[model samples]
Target: AALAQGRQPLLLERTAGLGGRARSLFARDVDSMIDNGQHVLAASYHETRRLLRRLGQENAIHFQQPLSIHFRFNQRRNFPFRAWRLPAPLHFLLPLLFGAPLSRSDRRYLFRWGRRFRQTVPEQLKPLTVRQWLDEAGQSPLLEQLLWEPLTLATLNTPLRQASAFLLYQVLQKAFLSSAATSGLGLATRLLGEIFARPAEQFIRQQG
Candidate 1:
């Protein structure tokens, strides 16, 4: 839609036939079959969903409904949070009531943080890492290690110890809302090359 609506720039950066990231090349006698990883897309990707639907390929893509979150440092230990897409305004509160990974106290602070942000000017709010927020809120290191640390690292792709506490708090706050909105989403599993590259090239050649 962005391309159709002139909201995105159109340009081909490379000149050549595009290729898929073939994962395995199995030579079976006279024929060779390649297997690739199953690609997954986030249900919340409105643009990709819209484009696929427009191309009549929505069926090829799958939606994992009642989105659930899974966390693991290892396979033996994992925490799961399940959620349902709420109708509307009520959706915002469900994460608090259910499908939340945070401890009851941490969850309360997450809400309080948002309410505080709403009431204060952005410039005045103290900036710190998620760890800082946890500490300031009186969350123990043990809780921080199991909870905020993983969440911060998972969301920011940065070590919790290194991340800015203030920024992390805001990021955590944002993720919390988005998760609530979508019944708690984690990712779109599709590889960049498979989901976007070929189709994009095809679209470009057709339109160019």
Candidate 2:
């Protein structure tokens, strides 16, 4: 924001790396550089995408359109989660209806909750935890294990029992309930050091 306002911003780093917590490391055991953390980017990450665009590192990320993912339950079995080309909600809904290993009761409960979710505002869920919200929504243990738990862990980086429901709802609104294009999954083509930290540092230097 400071740079956009014609100000020369001075970036200071306490550590030697640029990306702070989202950085890379050289492990002697591996004999190569590796990311300290794994990051999965979503198409709904508008601000992040904009920043990468500004850094001229847009090509460093690759997006998978039509929203396809494979979740492995065991070495022998996996679930294929693919969204339809339909509009918002339906794209995700149809896939869940046909592809997911959900019981009829789970489906009914989810549909009811989906209606309530659309009607309620983010503030309404402010006091609730993700686990509480799911429980109140009549989410089955199987449903929670198959979908909600993993989704919450991946997106919020917080355990379901502790993560705020409001934030999870907002993520659902933006990443899944939004348009198909926004729901697509994106991944960095390179390591965090090469794709983000190094490129961002170079960008800042060039701006000066």
Give per-residue CA lDDT, model 1, range 4-96, as digits (tens).
775556454443324343233344774753334333344555676687766545665556555555656566766665554665323444554
Model 2: residues with Cα > 4 Å off, grouped in runs: 8-15
| lDDT (Cα) of model 1 | 0.53
RMSD of each: 6.9, 2.0
Quote each prediction's TM-score: 0.51, 0.89
Which runs in model 1 stand beyond 4 Å of their true positions? 1-43, 52-62, 73-77, 84-181, 186-190
Model 1: lDDT of residue 9: 60
Q: Which candidate is the best by TM-score?
A: 2
Clashing residue pairs in candidate 2 are none
Query: What's the alpha carbon RMSD for model 1?
Result: 6.9
Could you say which candidate leads in lDDT?
2
